[model samples]
Target: MDDDDDYWNTSETKAKAFNFDDDVLSTQEILAIGQKSYSPSGPSEESLFNNISITTVQSAAIPLSSLVSSKVLDLILLAQSGKDPSKETKYEPEQTVAMTLKRLTLGRSCSLHVHRSMKSKTELLDGALAIGDGNAVLTVVLFLIQTLNKKLVYELLSSRPVALNHYIAFLQNEGKISELADLLTMLGRSPEAAMYQYQHTVKTQGNNVDVLLRKLTNLLANHFNQPGVDQHQAKMISDYIKLLEWQKHVNKPDLKYNSVIQWLAYNCTHHWHEGAGNAMSPLTLCQRHQITPLQYDWVVLNVHAKSGKWDIVESLFTKKDWFGRTTISSNIPIETLLSRLSQLQASKQLLATCVNKVANSDDRLRLAHMYKIHAVVIETLAKQKDRSALTNYKMTLNPQSEEYILAENTLRDNSIKWKN
Candidate 1:
């Protein structure tokens, strides 16, 4: 009977649970025991809990409550104590984690268990501010996926709209971009339904947003290539691509100063993806939003020029035209006025017309600068002074006008280069 009692005591099931609260464990010892259970070479999250080493002399992770009960996990408890645990508004880590684990292990058999934990978690997250609980809220947002905690997902979106932007940024950093696409689209439709449906699918689908983007982009490109997809569908695909790109820059707090312009330039042109062709011009969207035509023109001008689209390049000069008895003048340079003035000859008359129609000292001064660029172009193209055109230009320049001085200053500069 003595031996039987001893054997019973020695059995693994009867052993006391691991207690990590005894001392500040050495890093090496913690790592050693950690390797035994968590597998040193194993995948992530198997690492020591938190920024602390609690692997040595442990049970199954100290049942979160005991950690809180022992004051070792007070941060978790403190965060919870800020709000009630039973309310459907706070986030209780211990109960939440336990409920998640139960749902994961038992599947549908314990779905109710996960829902209950989600309610507990909601209470914990309720009163917290955006930046304070941002990380924790995002962590739960993601973890609830594997936990299959839909209750928490709904609670988060419905009550914690404050953290939605940060939540997007978190998902972006984690490289789960497909989450956004799925969140924005569904056969079911509606933003709320799409939101929850996509959140629920995370654990099942896994992370491969990059791959999904490539494939989806490719699919859309091919679909649009078909004869009947229609321009509207093509525009939808383009907007989605732009939205995806914008999400990449979500950390930027402002949008009015062309933050998106640079990103769009680099993303769409740096790589030669056939799918890239499917992206519609951002200028089109900007126009729809009631932005001035000039702003759209400016963006296209820089982007196309930088990307080396010669046919689209237009030289700048003043332009004027007659309307009945009235004359209206434009500040736009000659090349810009003619629209597709890529051909050298086409630009010449365009330039002449602009020079003849100038109505002011400022316009004439601008014309002198225009003439200077013309002279250089002619010299390069003809290998001799196009004396007639040069003489005509000289005749048009007003020496004391802003045009002559402005043209002279620019002409004296050493860096001007003309390219087709």
Candidate 2:
């Protein structure tokens, strides 16, 4: 019985020596031990955790309460905060490294996830703005364009100037010229959009003059001529359009001045000024391009004459004074007018009218005789009172003609002096 008790005591001693729970530890003691073993090493680990939490908070990268999609938010938060919402557990070392890399390259690592969600565009924009990321704001704008159409996107952006500006910058940087122009148009900034297209064309197609002119002309005809634009801007656009159109017409391989004249007349008479507010008239265009008055008159004369608008052609050379006395404008010489008119197959009555305006009788008689303006020839001979010259003029006329008879009657009246 002594040996049995000694063996049992030895076994109990051995068990006590090996047993981990020999001392009935309290909960606190157990917890303290566990913490000492599993706790992070220092404040650095705590600081990292706190920084991630702050980044997630400040970035507004997640909507914890909102019913909107959290995928984009979760990815952004995961990229920035190094925490995955899908997995609440601890990260493996490889995953931690990967997430760190993703954080380092934010936009490149994850493109925007623009999945359809319950959020309205305004709500999405607000959320993006809350993050204060320009790229994020632009991404939301693009998503808005895709989902709600550009029309609604414009309305939404109209209220959000900052976001609109950010998206503009993004489009410019990305070379999205057409989309940018469309946005500008939808915002009631069509003139600015037209100018943007003009600039773009000038930059890209400038080396090819024909192509450049074609594109610029089309833009002006279509967009720059909009009446809803500001008056001053419209005038500027009008002038530019005219310039481009003129260039296009003038640069043609087979250019005709008559065609140009007709084009100018048609535009000025109808399209240029009637309802086109601030558009330059043909005369205004001529002046702007430094065409001289005489050159313009010549062009006008020939153009009207060819069109059988003889009265308009005649009216162009005359001006009415304040007293309502109609006289030749005298901007062009009478002789030059007569010569051109004659070439245009002017009426004999027109020729006589021109001959009658000559102040020099000798020159008048000579021109009158040359043009066969018989009435002017006889009148000029009677005014000169040179019977010998009148007789010589009579030799050129048929004796039976009235002009010849008038010359003979003038000679017989001897009040006409013989400049013998």
Candidate 3:
């Protein structure tokens, strides 16, 4: 026995000689090991029930409940306007569905009476919004502000922004930024919903990107004389004579001539302002829209084309709107501009025009413009020119350019990768 004890002690000493820190176990693992010491088979049911308590669930956990009553389940299905008897939910299934299943199980009260006499919260909210019932609207909005889901509390907001805004303002009034992210994320994913929400948010918050761009332009202009050379140059180039021309054309009384005239004047940033002379001013609308620069450029171009800036279509291709279809530009007018641009090669204003108007829709005319652009680019490059109009135009107009073709190929490959 003495020899056995010495042998065990020697083995224990050798084990202790190793770095325990290197083989340290987590508290959970240590607790598991400790638990094995008593019963060894592992934790008994008694200990598990004694030591653990559930606090919360991100999702719900409904339990099997005969008390929920089949009749009540039928009523819920009917309430949802579901006619299919096969789709009927069972008492146990509600156990996992989020909500007060426990309360539902207490079928002691006449739930049908309660369910029928009182409209589910959603109907009440929708009805109130329909009648412009402020009290109901306020209550629903406050609840929405507090929680993303109004499944039980109120009806989900309808797809209309005006209608939705009617609710959003109510939420904002109740200070509901806390629970807005999930809802906003949903809205952002939905094109129409996002636009609606955007307009609503702008109306209520008044801190939208449209206001920011105006501030940026004004700030850049005011601080043009500052010490930083780059900042000053940005303002100078930005405020160049063409900026005014573009703005004048953009703001002209003839709404038909302007490139982008939204119902809201405050929203259209000077994205394609090719003002007097060849000097032009370009501003990005993507920063405000929360889209990629390339994606943003695509949206801006479409908006421009839709609006009327038939001349300012090239902004889609200037190393920004990457992968955008050059053929799409042919849909806009490139022929008329091509002749004017042919003579006007050596101006920054014209250069901006070239960049902004690179999207030519007419294939034959666009091809002609491409040829003219190519000619102008060769001349400018030979003379060591610094961004002539034709040079800028050539940079974007020629879809056949090696760089343009490469970018198009890469973009196409990426699209395939993502879709697959």
Candidate 4:
């Protein structure tokens, strides 16, 4: 018996001395232990029940019935509570729509949800608007506009001045110029509306120049002939007409003339003097309109060249620079000018003077080929003396032609001279 007791004491001491640090508890083991130790009557259970009761009491403190008559709101709350909202709330479509709009006007952030809810209740919204429910009308109208319900928005804004004004402001903010113009006209501001429509049409539909002209003429003759219209506005219209007429004459049917007309209109509006004479020359018009050198050349080609105004065409090339400064002695390459003159079949003296002004070999060759000038061709061929250039020039003409034979002989003579 005493040996047994001593052995048992030794075993107890060894068990007490075993290292616990090496045997860490895993998460599942710890959880199992926690579950085993848990009791329903514990302090944690009491605190949980107290918290739940407190939350229930707080929720019951607010009378939701008096605040929102919407079954949809009730359903939304039920959904947030993880319950079936549709089963708990009564189905009242009209009341739900009215409540949704009210909530929207009261600055709720659930507009998308409200819109979804009100999708099928448009008649309720319209009825509310008809009965002069200002709040509901504004909310629904803004919603329709936001959702791009153009048909409804137009219907609502048709006869309602206040609503129309709001829609017009919205269209203006969105840069819907055509819609804004139509609304403005409906509101009896026809002259202002016409101006906007005209500007818009000119910008977007400028290819329809005849239509634009007709519209402008009708506006001037019919709409803007009132006493209250500003004279400057009238002047603007008249200047636009003149500018359009000028562009119509200058550009072909296939050409884009809007930009040119816009430039003219800009200058006519800003730079033109009221009493400026109608006798203004093309150069004066160019100067006033601030035409670039490239644009000036285009005008000369299209207008002066086609009109048999050779002197005017020459003056365009000979006169001022782009900024209206005198460029007669500015050493411009007259190759292009000479080419144009050659096309017009100018006199030999004139061509010689122009060719002398630049004195480019290439220009002389081009002139010789362009006009079939024997003297210029012989001079250029002798100067260059390139066998290949002479051959190519001969090939471009008839094989047995006099010009070809002369060019070949010129090349042979130059080769003999070089050999000497």
Across 1-420, the per-residue lDDT of candidate 2 in tens digits comes to 698677767966665343366454333333344343345662444454664765444433234335323543344444445444446565544323234224423665432333355344466577667667776677667767777766777888888899989988787777788998999988988877877777787778756666876787777678766787566765665555456566564454333223435555654444433442334466655665555677677766776788787887767666667987555664678888888889999888778877877888888988897889988888876776667767788898887888778877877885656676
The numbered model that scores best in TM-score is 2
lDDT against the true structure, per candidate, is: 0.45, 0.66, 0.41, 0.58
For residues 1-420, write the lDDT of model 3, one tens digit per residue: 698678757967655343457554333333333343434476554554564454432124334243354544444435445344345555543222113222333322212222221234444445556655454455545544454445433235545344566655654566554344345435542333233333344345343334534544554454333443355355343433233344444454444223322411323335245333322223332222223444444445555555666455444433334655232233234444444444434233343345335443344334434544344333333233323433344457457875445434443442232321
Top-lDDT candidate index: 2
Off by over 4 Å in 2: 1-242, 245-262, 265-280, 319-327
Ranking by lDDT: 2, 4, 1, 3
lDDT of 1 at 398: 75
- Misplaced by over 4 Å in model 1 are 1-119, 130-133, 146-148, 151-155, 186-218, 221-353, 358-420
Ranking by TM-score: 2, 4, 1, 3
Model 3 residue 315 CA deviation (Å) reads 30
